[model samples]
Target: MEEKQIIIRGRSYPLFRCHTLIVGSGAAALNCAYHLVSFGVRDILVVTERLGGGVSNNSGSDKQTYYKLSLFGEGQDSVYDMARTLFNGGAMHGDIALIEATLSAQEFYHLAQIGVPFPHNAFGGYVGYKTDHDPKQRATSAGPWTSNQMYQKLLIQVRQQGTEILDGFEVISLLTVGEGEQKRAVGAIAIDKNKASSGLDSLVVFQAENVVLGTGGPGGLYQTSVYPKDHLGSTGVALEAGAAALNLTEWQYGLASIKFRWNVSGTYQQVIPRYISTAADGSDEREFLNESFPSFGKMGTAIFLKGYQWPFDPRKIENYGSSYIDLLVYQETVVKGRRVFLDFRRNPAWKGGAELRFEELESEAYDYLHKSAVLFGTPYERLQKMNPMAIQLYAQHGIDLAQEPLEIAVCAQHCNGGLLGNIWWESNVKHLFPIGEVNGTHGVYRPGGTALNSGQVGGYRAAQYIAECYRESTVTAESFLELAGPALERSVGLAEGALGRVASPNGRIWLEFREELQARMSRMAAHIRDAAQIERALAEAQAQWEAIHRFEFRLEDPARLIEYFRDRQLCLTQLAVLHSIHAYLQRQGGSRGSYLVVDPQGSASLEQLGPEWRFRPENAELRQWVLQYQFDSRTHHTAWEAVRPVPEDHFWFENVWRSYVNKEVFRDSADSR
Candidate 1:
């Protein structure tokens, strides 16, 4: 790799040339860097806004799971079986599913080998348990910090391998060349937060043959989001660079604590804490669930089931299923304008002061509580008995489960869709790979903890493809300048214009824009959706997207320029997501995945909710096609492609060995950008 300086708008900015430029420092991004070094590809650079600030290091549930191939006492399990399960999830490419299934064990072992501390039996067998949407018992966990441990272990490996890391840089634009099939990712332009206070000199450029985008999901799009505060995603820049998005409408929304921004899943709900609501001024508190549910047993059962069925699935709403609790919470916080809280200090109160008799509860809930020996205590006591770590975790963040109520909301947790990638995790743009949550590998439905597995598999696949096929760059310094010149000029112009604008000292322009965008997304594009609201939101998003480009900013602090760029990225991402949702509604798409599509002529209805909450069932046939959306800097385009079927090819050992030795395994991967 070589370092130089490039002048943009009379300000000299740093530039580096490398074989690969990784645009994040999360677990997946670090894993890619480690694998690149192990594969003998050393000319790589990693850029991130901050180390250990993304979701991988900062988010978890009560018992964070890690999905992988069953390695021990299994009734039966195979790569083909796992592939079929992932493929059947709907709107997922069969080949990509096969790749992920095939690599699950390898990635799992890599984590375990690098001190992830996954529990094992005395016989050295890794036991597994069932998770949501999983047929086989293929989920495992170390504790509540499974992904955080993975991030820490992988960071050690990456640092040990001497991979160059550049922190405090936020990517603003991807450098690309050509158009259509010939298009390719050259590098990226980033805003140096540390140097932004020095004005236009903050812009830095990277010239590389391949760019690995491991940035996480679009977490900034919603006001009520569970993603970590520091990890606002950079997916908008890739979309602006013409990366097609797939299944953008599929997202996971669930209950999470707002104060500490942690998931309140697993034992937190299994303990059956009291659900209460209060007036805006914190008075008039009452047990809200008791008024809606028919009996203590039914309500208790629903709350217990929420431990595992955490995500808000429309299918689970009828008959007071686990997700009904999600709807009730949504009703209280969003619809009724009340503050909802989980009172762990006491068990839920039944109508007429009827006690919650464990034996009278549903067998599933009853058996689990009986097996865990937690049938005789308050919710916090039961939680302390089952998992004291859940309590300590909150204590670490200044929240005590035993002392006070925990405020929560039905918030956006994860996106099941993102930039479309191939079997090797390469996007349509040649040389650009989107791994981790940024890559749309998961579909309408996925097993719990599958995102972690997919991120590792994607990093391994992307690294191998880069090392074997794209080992060096062909662009010299002169050619690199020609390619990145226009994009550089546009970014500098935006920065200059924003800095020159005048505003009052109290005006936090970025915060104003961010709140407006997040509020609109949470209202119109969250778990509950209506066609009319989506259409209106789409129009409003477009106007805001345009407004962000020309919005004035106070030069009171140039170091705050990263916020302006982040706001722009978030605005574009919100616009693209709205376009996707509007397109889905136009196609007569209905309630599916993690969200509900409300319609006036719908066939389904919730018991306690009004006609306005009536929703249409999913269109079964739509599951056979993946929704591909693109925004080419002007108009939003939508296309549908049939789901690729699982591969049925017979593999001959000798033939496979020949292909492996000849380096033909990556036949579809690009050798140059």
Candidate 2:
């Protein structure tokens, strides 16, 4: 074939090589970049396919219920709460020191000042509550697009710091120097912004001493994914760079992605099956849905079967501490000849919202008034003006959720385990720092809403560390050009490889492989696991590796996708998965949140509905909602008989009282307090 090469800027550029290269631009990547800049390190180059949110765009989980609220518990959740949650949430083997010390709570607050809007409660207050393992309510956020919002703000900060952003560029590998002993990461190899490799541009030699690998996780390896991100921009690249791929095989089943082929792709095209709710007495209520599926068929099937139908606590339903939907619940349904459903029409919320025709307002004042009206026992019509997604889903779909139950299921979502690294976001290898969905800072089943917080925290921490650590390194134009050379050559070869002979075989086979993988992974990696299942999964993953090696591939980008799959396979190796799975199983103490001991038949304890809340039911007409709640402090502690009592031993009464208030948090998350 004739040469398809070109020169640019008076220089013949090769593909690979660069100094201070970042692989992803998601929350993790952006956060790290910003944090790196904050550290006073300037020779930063961020190479990514996009500059927006991470995996969150695909997260269809109901976001109306916020994470931060006026929660009054033991510690009143703060930056400290994040550390506690990570420890309690089975990140026992994680780099707790980094999390404990580095995550940026102030940075999260700063995002708000940067124009990211946080949802206000009816009283126009910054709403917050104890969600899952978070102590107090420090998890302030800006709607469901927290990741997107954070990414936007962080991107602005990154650019302002004078770092060059190469968007849509594919990073092919890490550029190392010295033979072996003197081996160090000076930079990375990447294609130009167009993602072309006909000839390398800016090849090999963006020279800088400290390189950080912020490549993302390995979720794309599965046949189905919440991430429509193509271009082989995943942990596979980190692994290919020989970063000792630790805990890679220990792939955490992200919020189970559904199996579906959207008319479109990427997170924006995500569609969820409607899920309905009914009163505790089976007196049907409205349906509410926010959860998104990476896949539909599988997720729909899981939900059709209904919860392990775990009941919500009447008293603390908002917190829903013990009401975690078990992964095994769906697995059992499948194993027992039953399948989950993706029903939407039956959910109760849709019908009521359809009947109401109310649109929620975005202001804080109305929210407080709505609650005030509820405090005085106002009519239902006034409450719904604040809740719009519910109404829109109903009116738009014309499906009365009250009359019918909405179908729902759990599919894979985010990657809890990614390319392993230190708390600083650096992979085992030098210079490359894997961040966001690609970084495996978390183990399996990350607590709800933690990804945003963690990414922000990790980014800030990594940047600060890099700046302080590499204050002596030089980052200049000439040095960068020097590092760009080798990378150019590598990019050209890989781009050619992408277009060479390869076959994906049948998409059907790929689907089956994914299903089998899920089944194996779920059993071995679910809420409660056993040694046998872990070993079994290890064996199966090993076999799959061999099979994938034999599988055909097309020499297009999907070929890189094939390589991506292998990256996930390497991640699934026994070392990664077994260590954490076994670690989770090994912790032989109390179980809270999602973890529960399965009976021999997989039946576990159903928790009691502890308390009841005075709710202001939403109604039609006003189209603007308000919320006002009045509760006697004396009544806050409902039958929390099992909770420990506050000690009068020379301590702040509130802190002491929270021990009694958040008994479950202390007991459940252990470290959150």
Candidate 3:
């Protein structure tokens, strides 16, 4: 392992070359190079350090897409009943697919005839509204930063469609070709983060035949989230250069609420996607019958397509309705514990507006309206008359999202499986291609605004399937440098010195094993999880991935060798979210997404506890009857629920189509000073 003959501008290269590059600049790599320069392919290239930081980069990138209604073979109402009532309010995924939840309004009127603006009124038309994963009313946004105002307007139509952005460039490996059935994928070996001479060369290694990752997700391993900071993890550097990443076991988590003197980049991402609350003793309207309502799984997959069933329990809403009971019922009036006001004094959405119960709209900008009328006690002459972006983000960074009930928690967004493919996104290697949030085409549990409608229909279907694999590849570039020139000379001879320094104890045992895997995923799969905290977070994620294979950054310092490729991608994406929260914590009979659930006569032993369960029955019921027929039909949930797919005795797949169903897109990240 020692091949480093570098050289760039003066020629002498060949560390890796496959071609079609594209790491990410968000909106699934600028709508996969504006659908590979509108299907003509004017030289496609897109590196990244910036550009909508993944998972609908907060939602802009030319007003993303997601409107429902397809009917896939007249299944009538079912991406599992719009994921159990408008997006997994009760953990959805029962092999979700009724033809990708009925082709989301033909991919939202084809991304509003491609340019995306979206916001229209005063007779301009098209505002349909109604979100929670559609039944009709549809979805569209441009204001409140619809994914950063449709990615600045698609990075100015991707630098006026010439395509070649670059930004910071990091990528490091993947350059394979030929060995096992003539392996494929040609170029990639980059680094340049501003390299010396600045002609971009901190170790220039360029070679390409085909590669596209749209690197996003893995949410900075986690500590807290709302994203928008710097979001690194380059899809764990393209699954440590081998690819394969399917639903690295569903890592999504949400708690994004914050108020106690507002901090997380001041007032949550741009007001929790667009606000609401009615509390004051109504406990934000009895937290939909006292807590247990957390389900943004694809705009709430139409509350299970409107039938709604949910009854399980994870301590019935953090034990009786919480965010502290929507801050003591709606907008204030606690008394000794402090939330005060007895009158919303003519409620502008709990008196501030984020559309109180979805649109009635009024309070246009009262920046925490005098600390939410001084924490609901009101009267300081209505807090110097109406507060404005909470008195200018509290006077810039002083934070006060309405008086003070904001300290939300939930973390780890994104990484809903990665690599692996079929429905045209490609990946078992070969010409490669991973479209948006490192493509796993939303496997485990993403259902809200479907990662800006699967990076606008998987970057316009990986730009018409890498332009029909480059008009049917006859293959060249010296047969992709004699097929990825010996896997880029054995990944630059496993990088010479083989890099060193493992113990940071494997990055402090992956940050105390991601804080005990976010307290065993807020307790075996939050929102409510069971089967003994999903067999004790899958036996503490197999002892936190055997201490992340005793980490040792294979030596090198591109910022601690990309945290040694994010400590083996947060231990293989936390062993794919502890084996998909031990298959929804051994579901006895119910649950498929929001935070694991399943128990009803399925003893799920490890201590057993089913009466209806408030929590405690162990080993998540025989690992949900051994992954419902062990990945029944070879998984991607029976190929995104088009069911009946996995039938070729054991591996090497054949027919798996599944596109974006009741889309639960959380693929997010962010950073700041």
Candidate 4:
């Protein structure tokens, strides 16, 4: 790596030049850097706002899973079988699924080899179990902090390789060259959070041959979210820099504790805690679920199913399914304006009498509890017996689940869709690879813990592609300086406008905008959707975006300028996502993934929920295509494209050897669009 200074707005700012620049410090970014060094491409620099603030390090659930090919089991498995399983999840492209499947073992073993500690038996077999949407037992875990373990181990490997990482730098722009289809990603521009008060010292620029974006999801887009608060994500920069996003309408929303921002999945739900709600002043406490569900057995079964059927899937809403519980919670909290809680301190009150009837419970719920020897106690006792780590985890966060009720909301947890990436994880912009949650590879319904596997596989593939095809910087120092000039000027302009402002009542403008956008998203575009409201919300988002450029916020502290830019980017992301939702609705898209499309003319999800709960069933044919959007210069262009089919490779030994040796294997650019 080389460093210099470039004059922007009559001030000298630091300029860096490297072969590859990584824009995050999560498990995927670390894994990419580690593999780049192993692949003999060592000129790398990783820039992150903070080292340990990402979701991979800070967020988890009960027994967070890591899905891969079934490594050791009596059931037979193959690469195609896994690929088909992933592809059948709807809206997923087959080629990308195939690559992920084919590399599952390699990446899984890589983590295990680097000390992730995915458990194995005495016979040295990495065992597996079933996860949501699984046809076979292909899920495994070390503990609740599975991704955290992966991040730690990968960080060790990257540090051992002497890779340079810049902490406290938040990337705000992707520096590009050329125009139209000829445009290429040359590098990026980031702000120094620690030095933002200073004029020239506040900005840093990188000129690299290739850029790996592992910035996770747009976690800050919604008010109700389980994503770590500090991990706001840099995807808006990529989207602004000519990257296309796919399936932006698909997201995973589930019940999660709000105060500490932890997923209330797995054993947390299997323990069958009591569901209650209270008024704003903690008055009017009532059992919300008991009133909605017809019988105790049905309610207990639904609660138990929430352990595995964690994500609120529209398909799981009928017949008093597990996701029906999510709707009830949503109604209690969002619709009725009350606070909901999971009370593990005592058993749910039985309308049938004081004594609970274990015999009357659903077989799945009864058998699982009976087999585990936890059928004879209260929810807290059952939790302590089944998974003590669940209680200990909350206790660590100062929320004693054993002593008090846990507040929860149906919150946005993951985006199954994001910036579009091809089989090798390269985005529409040449030399820019979006790995991890930023990459839209999962489609609609991914198996639990598959995100971790996808991130690992994406990093490996991006690194391999970079090592083979994008090893050298074609643009020279002077040329890079020339290409980065426009982006730098814009950054300087924004900074100039934001810095050294007088303290005013409007100083909280950014905060107000944040609250407005987050609330709008949580209410209008989350688990429930109304097409008319979404259209209006899109217009409001656009107006706010325009307001941003009009200097709506005055910053008393220049340090707050970082947040200014972050929210500025977030505004654009939110706009793009809303636009995507509107476009999908315009295309007659309905409730399919995690969200529901409420159509008054359609049937009610449940007759008792009233006409407002009416939602249209999914248009099954839409699953054959993917929704893609590109935002450029305030223009939103969205279209539907047929899903890419899985490729059939003939493994003729001699021909494969020839392609591998001559580097023809890396020459396929079919899906780079």
Evaluation by lDDT, superior candidate among 2 and 3 = 3
Worst 10 residues of 2 by lDDT: 633-642
Measured against the true structure, the TM-scores of the candidates, in listed sequence, are 0.97, 0.60, 0.31, 0.98
Give the Å error, residue 195, model 3: 44
Candidate 3 residue runs with Cα over 4 Å from true position: 1-18, 21-28, 31-42, 45-146, 164-182, 186-208, 215-243, 246-248, 251-373, 376-416, 420-436, 439-474, 477-611, 616-673
How well is each residue in 586-638 modelled by candidate 2, as lDDT tens digits?
A: 33322322333332332223322111211221112111111111112111111
Number of clashing pairs per prediction, in order: 0, 135, 99, 0
lDDT of 1 by residue, 262-296 (tens): 88999999998989999889998999888888888
Poorly placed runs, candidate 4 (over 4 Å): 500-508, 670-673
Give the alpha carbon lDDT tens digit for every residue of 616-643 in model 3.
3333222122221111111213111221
Model 2, residue 620: displacement in angstroms? 50
For model 1, give the 10-residue run with minimal summed lDDT. Answer: 664-673
* Candidate 4, 1-673: lDDT as tens digits: 9999888878888889899999999999999999999999989999998998999999889999999999997899998999999989999999898888999999999999989989999999999999999999999999889999999999999999999999999998888888877788898888888897764478888889999999999999999999997777777889889999999999999999999999999988888888889997899998878787788888888999999999999889888899998999988888889999999988887663563567778999899888989877888998998999888988999998878899999999999999998889998888899999999998888898889999999999999999988886699998776777887788778777866453656645678888899999999999999999998898899888887887777766666778778888899899888988998898888898898899988755568787678898898888889999998876989999998877677679998899889888889553544
